[model samples]
Every structure is written in C-alpha cells, then in structure tokens.
Target: MLCVLSLAPFSSPSQSRSRSRSQSRSPFLPNVRCLFGNGKQLQEKRRRHSKADAISTQEVLDLFDQLSTAQNPPPSIYQFNQLFAALVRTRTATDNPVFSLFSRLIQAEGISPNDYTYKIMMDCCARTNQVGLLFGFLGRFLKEGCKTNVVVFSSILKSLCWENRIDEAAIIVLDKMPKMGYAPNVVSYNILIDALCRKGEIEKAMDFLHDMMSKGQEPDVVTYNILIRGLCHNGEIEKAMDYLHDMMSKGREPDVVTYNTLINGLCKNGQIDKAVDCLHDMISKGFEPNIVTYNTLTDGLCKNGEIEIAMDFLHNMVSKGHKPDVVTYNTLIGGLCKKGEIEKAVDFLHDMMSKGREPDVVTYNTLIDGLCKKGEIEKAVDFLHDMTSKGRKPDVVTYSTLIDGLCKKGETEKAVGFLDDMMFNGHKPDVVTYSTLIDGLCKKGETEKAVDFLRIMLGKGLTPNLVTYNSVIHGLSKLGHWKEAFNVFRELVERGFLADDYSYGAFLGSLCKQGQSKVVNKLLDLMIKRGLKPSIFSHTS
Candidate 1:
C-alpha cells in the first residue's frame, strides 16, 4: 500500500519532542493524537522528502524505483510531486516528458497532481515552446474538474507569444479571456504588444494600447517603454517622441531603456545631431548614459565619415569612466578602414590592447580587409600569421578577404593556394570565394582554368550565381570562344536567371566579333523581342 504523507505541517525538532513528551504524559487526552505515526518517523519522512527535492531528476527517479520494490512502504504523492517538479525544472529540449510522467502518475502510480503540479507543468510547456502540449494539458486540466485561473491562461498566452503566434494570442486575450470570466491583465496586454512590435506591426500595437487605456487600464512604465521601442524600430521617431512626452504627461517617467531606444533609432536613421541632443537631454533628466548609448553614437559618427569626431566621443566616453569594449574598438577600426585609413585603425587596435581590451577576430578581419583593399597583401598575410600564432582561428571571411586581395593583385595562383589552405583548415569556401577566384582567372586570360573551377563549384553542389556566370561568359567571349559562351548563355537562360544588359552585351559582342551575321541577327531579334536594346559596345562589335 502507498504510504501517502501530507507535505505540510512539519514541526521543528524541539516542538516535536515537546509534543511527544506531552502525548506520553496524557495518552487519553482528546486532542493528543500523533498524525505522523511518531515524532521520529515524521522527521525521517521529512528528511527523505527534502533529499528527494534537492537531488537531480535522475537520482529521484532511481530513488522512486528503489522505494517501489524495497521492503519499506512505497513513496508518497509528495515524493512523486517532487520528482515531477524536478523533471519539469531540468528539462532543456523541446520534447514534453512531463505529459508522459503525468500519465504514469495517474495510471500507474495512482497519484493525483495538486495545483502546484499543474502550474509547474504549464510553465514547462511554455519554457520548452511546446504550445500543442500546453493546450492538451489545459484540456485535461478542465476535464479533471480543475478550476481554471488567470495563471493558467497567462501561461498559455505567454507560450503563444513566445512562438510568435500573436494573432491567436490576441484573440485569447481580448475575446476568450473575458468570456471565460478571467479578465486580461496588464502583463497579458504587454506580452501581446511586445510580440506585435517584434513583427513590425507598430500600428496594431498602438491600437491595442489605446484599447487598454479605454478599458481604464493605466499604462505602466513598461507599457510606454514597449511603445517607444516599437516606434523607434519602425523609424517613427517623431511619434516615439510624442509618446515619450505623453508618457511623462501621464505621470510615468521614461527609464534608461526608453531613452536608449530613442537614441538608437536616431543614430540608425543618420540623425546624429538629434541623437546627441537627445543624449544631452537624457543627462539633464538625471539618467546616466550607459555603454550602449555611447556605442550607438560612436558608430553613427564613424559611419557618417566623421571618424575624428567619433574618436573625440570615444575619449569623452572614457573620461566618463566608461571603458571601451571590443565592440567599440571594432566599430572604430571598421570606420577607419572604410575611409582607407588603415594606419589610424591599426593605432586604435594598439590602443585597444593597451587599454586591457583584447582584440577579437572581427578586429583582425577588419584590419586585414583594409590592408588588402589598400594593396598591402603582404601586411595582410603577416596579420593572418599573427592571428594564428595568437591562437585565434581565422574564419571564412578571413580567407575570402585574402583570396580576393590576391586575385585583384593578379596573383590567381596564390589565391587558389589560399582556397586549398582554407579547406584544409576545415573552413569551407563559400560562393564569394569561388567567384573571386573565377573572376581573377578570367581576367588573367585563364578562361579554361576558370571553367575548371566552375565545374568544381558545381560538383560541390554550389550553384553559381549571376555574377559567376557573367564573369565566365565575359571571359569566354573576349577569347572568341563563341560556341562555348553561347552554350553558357543558353544554360543561364534555362536556369531562369534573367539575362541583363551585361549578359546580352557580352553574348552579342562575341557573335559580332566572329562576323557570324546570321546568328548575330537572330540574337539581335531575340534581344529586341525581349525589349533589350543592344549596348553601344555590343553594337560596335
């Protein structure tokens, strides 16, 4: 028989002993009964339950198995609940093992779950993104005569929002919730609003906010923050500001998150001056600017070709006791590289290291790419070696940058060598790498080798994009390989890639150069039929 023990009403050791002494003195007393058999046995059961609760799920399951077959009485519902809670808590994958456990608890163990059990199971369903399982559990809960409450529906709504099923979640919140006698709370509305904003549905989110207010629900700071962020993301900065003012007017002050959202939006939209002004306003409002605010402003200045000003901002940020992180250094390095200022970028790299901030792969890649762009391939190669020596493995971007640089400098053979090295290092060369080498070989008058590379690319199950095909076709046409070029052109058309002006121009030019008047006239007719006028170069050829 299962020796079920109630989980509550555990007495302290001193109290148990005191009660034991009193019971021993008056065994005939009306209210002097031991509900737990004895004080010692009660403490033992409490100890066992505590151990079960503290151990891992697997260990608890093993203990349960031992209790089921041992000479001692079987474990209680409290122990089973502890095991179920452990299982729900420790689960990491998408699969819902709790459902199966629940069935075992009913059919095999003959144990009924309490409210805590149902709540934890619902939490598990939501955390694991098992929406279907959550609904199934809800049905079973109602069928078992369990009273429905806000927490249950809230868990379901949270799961729906997590899965991005906002429309269905909205229906449940605005319609089904009230019908079921459970009014949707501010938290429920906030979940739906955040989900809508994430999907770029700013207008729908606003309507929901207004609906919430019409229902006499005062929007909290969280509510205003969501609207501000959504508006900022959608580039509706003016509206976001209006709401910020409205939020303050409603006696709800904007938080750091609200100001940061506005600053990020302004920076992204290229209104750096306004972002700076907003930053000052934030300071005046007694909100300390965080690292994110500085990073956004610094990045915006760099992107707008105001690197010197951006550097000044970086100095000011350091003066404010804000440390420059990897992101800050990387952004500055990339900006300098973009302006062909590799030396200054390198100086910042040194500065970053001196400031006790380690340079990441992005920092190295940006520097390498800059050096390559400036025709400093040797220096780039040296940086590559330095990266490897420092135990930082170069990724595909690193190899591709080096290969492209070599190709541009007419070192196609070395580029191919780098490709082989990249593969040997377990980094697969992507389309850009292949296309760079192909274009390099084509420009070097090695069309046949380029064709071989294309064949290898196809063999690897990588479909050549338009740029690849265009490069090959142009190469073959320049070499007077009219038939092969035409075959490639026909393949391009058959593959459903639109033949642009460059495509038509190359094909027509080759045919014209060969003096193939009949074929040329037919090609011209097809181009005209397709509403493509021949380029001046194609006509001259």
Candidate 2:
C-alpha cells in the first residue's frame, strides 16, 4: 500500500475537516474519490504542445519577464501554463529556478492555473525526486472538486507508478475512479501496464491487460508494444512471440516496434538467424526498417563474431540510402579490434570520416585498445595525439589502455607517467586503472610501491575487488613474503572474495618456484576441503 501523500497531509486540520464535511455531503466515497480525466482528450491536447515543445528555458525566462512588465491585460493562464511546462521539461532544469518561476506565476494578478499547470508541476516534483511536495500540488489539483480533469489524475497515476507505488495507483486510480463513473481507459491501462512491466511484474501486467479487455477497452499498438518489450526484457521471448500471435488474431497489425523488440531479444539470446528472419518478415509485411533496426542487426552480427558479415551488412544498409551513423561504425570497429583485425578497424574509421560521420570517443578508444593489444603502443600514442588533435578528450579508458600496454612491455615508470597525465587531464583513475598499475608494479618486483598504491586506492574510498587482492597475493608470494601473502589471502577471503582457480594457481605457482613443495601440497588439501578443485596448473605447480 503506497501512500500518495504519506509524508504528511498538506491541508490544515480545520481545512481537512471542512473538506471531509463537503465530501460526506456528496454521494461519492470521500476516501477514494479523485480527479479523473479523458486520457484521449489529454493526448489530443499534448499533440498541440508544439509551442511548448519548441520553447527553451531562456525563452521561458524571457516570457516571464515580458509577463511581469506588461501594462494593461496580464498574460493568459494558458500562455503561463505553456511556459511553465517548457521550463519543467528542460533537461538542465534545476528545482529552485522552476519553483521560483512557478511561485511568481501564481502570485501574479489574474493568473489562475488550470489542470495543465498542476500536471506540469506534478511531473516536475516527480522528476526532481521531490515526491513529498507532491501532496501539496495534488491537493491543489483535486481541490477543484471530486470531478476535475482526468488528465491530472492520470498524472497522479503516472507519478505513483514512477515511484513504484503500483498497488496504490491501481486501486486508487484504476479501481476506485470507475466506481465514480470514470473508468480507467486504454491510455490509463497502458500507463499501469508499462509501470508493472518495468518492475518485472509481467504476470501482474498481463492481468491488467486481461482486465482491460474484459472491460471492452481495445488494446492499441502501443499497449501490445509495451507488453512485448516487457516480455522480451524478462527473457520470456517465447511468451512475447505468443502475444504477437494473439495481437494479430485480434486484428492489430504488428508494427516496426514489435519486430524490433523481438529482433533485439532474439539477437541477445544468440538466435541471429531468427533475428535476420524476423527482419525479412518485417520487410515482407510492408514495413520499412529504420536506422535503429539496422544498427541493432549490425551489432548482433558483430557480437556473434561475424565481423566480415557485419561489415557487409553495414555496406548494404548504406546502399539502401540509410547512412551509417557513429554507432554502427563504433560497433564494427570494436568487433574488428576484438578479432585482432586492427588495420581493417582503422580503415573503417577513415571511411567513417569520409562519409562525414564523426567518430566519437568510443571509436578512438576501441582502436587504441586494439593497437595496444597488438604491442603497437607507439602507434597507440600517435592515435592518442590524433584523438586530442581532433578536440576529442581521452578518458580514463584511453589512459588505462595505454598504461596496461606499457606495463605489459615492462615499462612500469612510463605507465606511472601516463597515470599522472591522466589526473592532470582532469580524469580520475578508477579502480581498474589503479589495479592495472598495482599489477604492473608487483610483476616488476616493486612490492613496497605496489602496497603504497593499494593504500592510496583504499584512501580514495575505492574498494579493491578480487583481481586487486589476487595481484597482491601473487606478488607477495613471489617475493617469499610468506606471512604477508597468507595474511593477504585471509583478508581476501574475509572480505567475501571467493577465490577462483587462478587465485589458488597464482599463489601456488609463485611458492612452487621457491621450492615450497610441502606447503603447496598442504594448501591443495585446504583447497579441496573448501570444495575447490585444483586446476592442472595448481597440480603441476
């Protein structure tokens, strides 16, 4: 039971009692009666949100200034609502500026906010994680009477669903509103279904679908799309496909979204052939595949290790008049790099530029990683310079890749230099970066320096994972620091780090070199006691 205004009621005790008296006089249930509006009408109204859609934050501020200084007639509440909606929807919008603008609007003479105004404010509260203040706005929205705009109540349902208050939203908005002669419509049902699906409540969402149909509210393409997407997301692809059949039997034609969702799901499940067949099926059904459709397929092909096939598919996509975007290029480059085809990946990068498609940070990072893995560190640095020259910033991944290459080549000091340069460039080293450096230092017999770095990482509040702990145990064991190595191993275990085969092997192999045969055998017995089978590497060690 999620509370809409569980934080605290906003109205005064006397005002609440007065409202209670007013509600009791009416024939409706005061406890459950809420504002409900026609969702179809709300959709129609939003379709006309062109002016609000194009309006920016600065333009909204300018409108406010104009409103404040206007001489005779003040601006209409409709105009005020449009500007308010634009401000609330701004991506970079902060709480204070929005509230300040809203506060000034309500205070202005002759400006009375409508359902649209309350809806925008409610959305703002939800977006800013200020749900506690939600009651104040909702109270005002519904204060008009029990029979206000359904759209505002729809906003309440959306807000509640967004907050994962599904049960309360369903009962209060879905079940109760209908008893007051305002049954939830298809749009209302879709909102609840989408919410439930997002929470992985597929069974409950399906129940809502059945209930919606039992009420004779026909499910639209959007409704089925949501169900299909949810089923696919939950790994119930077969069930999702069954819904597609059910939808067609009900005469609702499957749209591009339906096909795309199934294709993506099939690809992820390693059913590439089926994904391609689905694409063909989509084309046969007279639906043109969009850029998203192609990109998803190309990515699928790449992940399946069919790099050449993916490249060919991308070329086909381009020939079909759908230009390859940066994502398509990046995906191909990453696949080629993973397959050790660095030259081909570099060629694609050049080709991408020739086609006026700018390579992003991902493109450069993938290529740099490929070069480093091939021991072409010098070439990798050149590409790094090239990346910076093009005004693209090298992130932690860029620096980390270079550091790893340097460490592998036994250039520990140079790797440390790159770490400094990484910080100087305003990029903080993540745990992976620190771990790479520590591993390199330990491998070079710099035990004291490696320990210092471990302390620095911990001081920075970065928890060292299993890889980090494993590196320390291996290094300390190699240096014949038996006590410290065992202590570190114990610490790793107590920290809930489960040792894998490499964990045991690395430590045993290191000690084996020091002729600790007896110790190694005893350790093997302990490993078996802990339900860990010794790998051949451990037995050989």
Candidate 3:
C-alpha cells in the first residue's frame, strides 16, 4: 500500500481547453456592480440569509433531478455519494456495495465515469488484490474510449506481477500499448521492468530497456534505477553493476536508490568490501551516501563478522548528520549478539533509550533472545518489565523467548506461571510457546502438566504443530507411558501430519528405550510406507 508518486505533473488537454474557452469568452466586465449597490449592505444581507438557510434531503434530490434532466448535464448529487463510497472502500475493504453503487449511478444518472473514478477503483482493487475486477473495469474503460495512461497501468501492473501474471504484464507493455493508442511513458517502463526483475526475468528486463529506446522512447534515471534494483534483488550483482556502469557512461548520475540497491545486494551476497567500495564510489561521484546507504553497508559488515568496522561506520553516519533509526540499532545489536557481545548489545539498548529512540518490539526481542542465550534469564525477564513500564507491552516473541529460556534452565514452574500471565495480558501463547514449555516439562518428569497445557492449547483452537507432538511424545515415552505416547502418535497421523523426521526419530528412540521392539518395527514400516525415512539415530537406537 506504500505508493511513491513522481512529482512532475502532466497537464491534460481538457484543462487547457477549459482555459482557452474561458479566455475566448471575454475579460472581466469593467463596470460590473450589484443591483443592491453598496457592497457592505449586500454582504450583510448575504450573511443573514446564509445563517438562516438550510436544505432538506428532498430539496437536494429535486436539484439533482433537475440537473440530470438537462442534456450534457452537470454531475448529480449522487456523484459525491459514489466518491464517498469509493473512499470508504479504500480504507476498510472493497465490497460489492461500493462497486454496485457506482455501477448503478453510471446507469441511472448517466454519469460517465471520469479519470478519478477509475483511479480510485483501481487503487481499491490493488489494495484488496482484486486484480480481475480491475482488469475487467479497465477493459470497460477502453471500450468506453477512455485511454489507459501511465498511472492507470502502473497500479494494475504491480498487481499482475504480484499475482505471478508476468505474461499479462508483458503483453500490456509490449503488445497492448500501441494497440490502445497510448505510448508507454517512463512510469510504464519502470513498472514493467520492476515486475520482470521481481519475477527473475532479468534478460527480459534488459530486452524491455532496449525496446524502450527502439520505440523512440527515452529511458529516464528512474527506469535504470528500477532495473538496477531488480537485478540486485535477484542477486544478479554482475548484471546490476553493468547497468550501473552503463548509466554512468551516459552521464546520468546514479541517485541514492541506485547506489543503495547495489550496495545492499553486494552486502547481502557477502561482498561487504565491494559494497563499501560502492559507497566510496558514490562519494567520488559527488553523491552523498544517505542513512539507508550507510545502514546497508554497516549491516553487511556486521553480518560478515566485521563488528568493529560496522560500529565505526555507524559512528561515521552519525557524524555525517544522519541519525540512526531502529534499523541502525537493530543491525548493531544483532551483530553484537552474533559475536556473543551481550553486554554491549544491552548497552546499545540503553543508548537507544537515552537518545529518545524508544526500542520497538524487534529491539526488545533481539535483546531478550541474546540475554536468554547468555543465561541471563533474570535480566531478560527484567527487560520485559522495563518494556511494560515504558508502555511497550511484550509481544508473543518476548514471552516465548523468556519461556524457552526458563524451560532450558529447569524453571518449568516459572515458565508455566509466565504463560498464565501472558494469557491474562491478552497475548495468546502460540504453538511454539506451548512446545517449549512442554519440552521443558517433559524433561523434568512433569508429563501430566505438559499434557494439561497441550489440552488447553487445543481448547484455545490452536492445532498442535510438529514440535508440540514431538515434545509430548518424548515426554510420555520417557515416563514409561507408552500408551499415551502412541495415542498422541495416532492423533498426529490422523490429523495428516507428515510424521516428519523429528517425530519419527523421537518415537523410535522412545520405543527402543522402552524395549518395545514390536511397536518400533511397525512404526518404522509405517514411516517407510508414508515415504518418510527414519533418521540414523532413530534406527541405531
């Protein structure tokens, strides 16, 4: 739903025609005057009349009827209603009523659909993923002599590509444009190129770039940047670099997007040195690296285990008048955590707060995971408390990590207590939470409590995932309760679970430990029948 509009306005012929008509009529009348003379007295009468005036719905309807009766009529009052419906549909969702209302207005009042009408409906359809309806309406518009311009095509092009209709997008771009008497603008080319790149059609994207020039249409900076970004996105770093070089050779300066695109790709592909070189390349070209550019490079360095250099780049970003946002802090924290720098990660969290940048859920989640991993479960718990005090409630992730941490530390009772508190706080325990707690309980010989929580999770309408089944099965089997474990296994198979590697492995191990060789052989046969091979450990045990 995020849209970026190119700022340069296109002046339509209709506006010019209106202006010409007004100018050809006459200039303002030199001696024009009100019949009621003295302007102050007339203004007073008008104010009194305006204050006393009110119009009934019936009166409004009558006026609309009168207006519609004329040939070449002005729009009726229902025009506003149709517009309102479209606006409402855009916000909430597009339903039948809004479309039905517009169709009715078009039929009943003879109100020809205008550009705004089509644009609004297309936007609604795009938002709701109703591309078929959008295409149908576009066909209607074409039949009605309304041309599909750049904006109209751009809106639906993304939808088509998103829905994996790349063929349709190509047809619209290459075949349909000339047939419809509309030339593809820069925006049109950008859409097609972006779509092709997203679909991994890098060669086709290049072909479109060539086709644009062959058709005598000039490609702008936006067009090249789209292709560059698309190539980079698909990890076609070499191809993206070629396009970047081609753009530079033409004296078309690569903007922030171009540099950022290449830098992000390089960093992501483990070419952090090259990405940094690209950043310096931008500076050489007299183009300043924006915060996004620096963030991408820093994140890449951090991912590459160059944590100190990444921090230095972050400091350089701050010195260059770029304030690090959440993404900046997240990259740093994530990198520090990766290197087992838990204290520094926590310090960064404190720094984020001291600088008035409140840590979002991701920030808290990262810190929580790091702290938990470092066996600082108490600090992680306290972090959650601090989050709540700062009015940022713990999300499912925060609770899940803490619960998992507690479970690992043999604090099953505290983990269960936390789950209860989470439920009371309106954060439902997902399957992962249940699985973690169940695994912890099963290991601690608390099979009955694990079973109880599993039942409650099911009662809450959450189906037990593979991990939940594995935990409970392993728990029951460990307690010499083979019947309950087998029952769970049966229930899982009945629900059409894949009886995946972990589940089969855990079951076979339990059966072996219990000396139930008969059940173990039968389960292995069933696993093979289901085309699931048991793990080596499962077989050897």
Candidate 4:
C-alpha cells in the first residue's frame, strides 16, 4: 500500500504528461481510493497489483527521451522539479533514474536548475546515503548563486546527522559556507541537541544547550523536552527533575509532554508520591489532563500498588469530561487482575465493551493471565476462544500464558500439546515459550525430555538464559544425574553465567539429600567466596 501510494505519480509517460499539464492534480485518484482502510477488499485488490510499486527504468528513460529529444519546447524547470520531488518521495526508487535525467536535462535546450531543483537533489543524496555527493551539490548550489535559506542549512545538518556524523555536522554548520553569511539558529541547535539526546549523549547534548545559550539562542520547549526525556530514559530521574526546575526558572513552562515525561520517570523510579504531586501541579497550572496524562498517572498508581487510587483516577478522568480510552481501561484492568480481583476486572471488560472500547490483545492477555493465576484455566481458554472469534489472533504471550497455567496445574502433557497447536497456527515457539515448557517438564521429572527440548532450542539458535539453564541443572541433580549436572554446570560457566542463588541451591540440595556433606561444604565455601551467601530457602532446597 505504501509503495503504490508513493509511486503513482511517475509510473508512466501518460501519467507524467498528464501531471505535467495539470500540476494541481493530486496523484491519488479519489475514485480509486476514497478513504484508507474503508474498502478492505479493494485495498487488498490494489495491494495485489504491487508490481506497480517501482516504475520501469525503460519507461522513465523513455519519458526523459521525449522531453529531451522532442521538437517541442522542454517542460518547465518547475515541472522537472515536481517530477524529481515525486520520485524522491517514492524512496528514491526507479533505479534512482532521477539523477541521470536531472544531469541530462541540465544540458538540454533552455533548461536551468532552480534552488528547488538543488534542494531536491540534496534530498536525493541524503536518501541514497551519498553524503560526498550532497556536499558537492551544496558547493554547486552556492557556486551557482542559488538563494540560500534555512532549508539548505537544515539539509546539510540533517544529511550529516542521518549518516551519524554529528561532530562533522556541528562543525560544518559553523565552519562550512561562511561566504553564505549564515549562522546556526535555535532550530539548528535544537536539531543537534535532539540528535545528541537520542544517542544518549546527554552530557554532550547539555554542552550543546550551554553553547546555544552562550551564543544568545534560547532553548525552546522542544530543546528542554528532548533533554528531559533523554535523562529520564537513561534513569537519571534526579538530573531530569533538576532540568524540570531549571526549565521553569528560565521561563519555559512545562507542556503536557514535559509533565508526562517527568511523571513516567518518577513512576518508574518508584517515586509514586512525586508523580502524584506532579499531576496536581500540572492541574493547578490549568493544564487539563488529556488521555495521556490520565493514563500515565493511572498506570503509575497501579504499578505502585495503589489500584484503588487508579480506580479513583479513572472516575476523575470521566468526571472531567475526558472519556477513558482503551489504554485507561486496560491499565485499570491489569491492576485489578494483579490484586486477584478477577471479578472486578471482568466487570471492567464488560464496561469497556458497553462503552464501545474494543479490547485489544493486551486487554485479553491481562484477563487471561488473571484467570490463569486464579486457577480458572477453563475460563482462560474461553477467553482465548472469545479473542479469536472477535478476530484478534492470539500472540505468543497468550499461548505461553496458557502453557504456563497448565504446567502449574501439573498437566505437563497438556502444556506440551500447546506447542504443537501454536506451531500449527504459524506461531513458532520463542525463547520464553520454549523456556516455559522446559521448566514445566523439568518440574514434572521429565529430565530426559527436558534435555532433548533444550537441544532443540539450541538447534533453533535460541540462547538459553539463566532460567533455562538452572531448570535443567535442577532437574538432572534432583534425579541423581550429578555427572550430567556437572557437565551442564561447566557449559554454563564457559558461557559466562554467574551462579545465582538458585544455581547454588540446586547443587547443594541434591548433594545434601545424597549425604555428601563435605562436597556441599566445599561448594558453599566457593559460593561464599563469590559473595553469594545462602538463604534459608537455599539450604532448604
């Protein structure tokens, strides 16, 4: 669909000629596409004709031949620019024939490239990863005395940024093209700051911020948001908060995004009280809570074990004329499910349906998980049926949850059956899916089968994690396969796995049961030397 939408303009000479004649015509035929996702059958029909995604190289060359070799006056440079722009929008496709046509047209009768033409070429160069060509084009753009604008400077900075050569971009903006009499503006600084922040170079981004201020270009809301988000994302919540105060001191009032970033950060850092206070502060400043604000706050409360408060927050959102969205409902449902309030969570599901809020995979997964945890496996399976009937295909997590529940119920065979069912439905088992089965089989004393499955997991190129490895070790050691246990343990050490409490406990428990007290003591000494003190549970194991 994306490919067709992009290539419709330059697919044929007739279409290109028609476009040349009537520049105002939109490429999308309204008769063919009235509204996106409206006519599903028609959309599929159009998608099947995806061969039209790329314009034939011969067809484009023929169009150029007609333009360059014809007796008629050539198309206006503006028309040529339009063609280049359209071709660039198609992801620089068509074997990148635009550049050849552009170069050949530059030598044609009465045709001259305009500033827009140069800009289009710059965009093409950026898209094609031809940075050296981009600089060459930039020099020509200046040598030809084409008018320089913010877009041209931005093109260079953005092109360099795209190639991840930020230092060069930064220096070029200050060092290159001084004759053009241009300096980096606030937008330019913001672009660099944003790039730095996204790369988690927060210190460098801050340095850019200081440089921007020192150069008399003030940081705007975008500048502050980028830095704050970077700080928060890197778990520097304290630094993010300091910036929040700093932004206010500099008279850059917080926006919804600012509040949401801080709130999410505080929630993640387990500072729920601060997150709540941030909400109050936002509201007191006359900022009406949007869906994102309410949803973030609700999720924060739920994660902090304040499900009742999240419930109240939902009512508050509705009372304030903000309808609870699917996300809002899902968060509350998840919180209720976590509290073992399955009945209330189901009530929310009904309420959500009544309110015309469709339940997505997450909504159903939460309910299914809640049912599984409550040992109502039948109801959970019913939820699976309800999900498929409603046209939402179950994801890996959904089937894995079912497998986990069945295993917990000691029905390992039934759990194993789900692997076949999942694969038959075109969902290959992921690491978690296979790990769950391996753990279940091990717990069921099916060590040989579990070991075989582990081999299969590796055959499929899946790296077994600590849980998978520990599960195998526990199963083998429990059944007195100490030799195999030691082999597996050696492989784990070779793979650089530090022995966790579970790993130590598995060996200690098995040896203790076999009355190998001296071996257990030596292992304990090694564990203590590695700073892993055994817990009561570890000894019990």
Give the Cα-based TM-score of candidate 1 against the true structure.
0.80
Q: On a 0 to 1 TM-score scale, where does candidate 2 land against the true structure?
A: 0.83
**Model 2 regions lying over 4 Å from their true place:** 1-58, 88-98, 126-130, 144-146, 500-529, 533-540
Q: Write the per-residue lDDT of candidate 4 for residues 181-239, one digit (tens) a residue.
A: 77678778877888888898999998888887887889888888989999988889989
Error of 1 at 103 (Å): 8.8
What total of clashing residue pairs does each candidate reach? Answer: 0, 2, 0, 0
Q: Model 1: how far is 122 from its true place, Å?
A: 3.0
Clashing pairs in 3: none
Which is superior by TM-score, 2 or 4?
A: 2
Give TM-scores for every candidate, taking all chains together and pairing residue i with residue i: 0.80, 0.83, 0.74, 0.76
Each model's lDDT comes to: 0.80, 0.78, 0.75, 0.80
* Stretches of candidate 3 exceeding 4 Å from the true structure: 1-151, 155-165, 201-207, 500-502, 526-536, 539-541
- Candidate order by decreasing lDDT: 1, 4, 2, 3
Error of 2 at 336 (Å): 1.9
Tell me the tens digit of each residue's lDDT in model 3 across 449-497. 9999889988989999888888888788767777788889899989888
Clashing pairs in 2: 36-150, 37-150
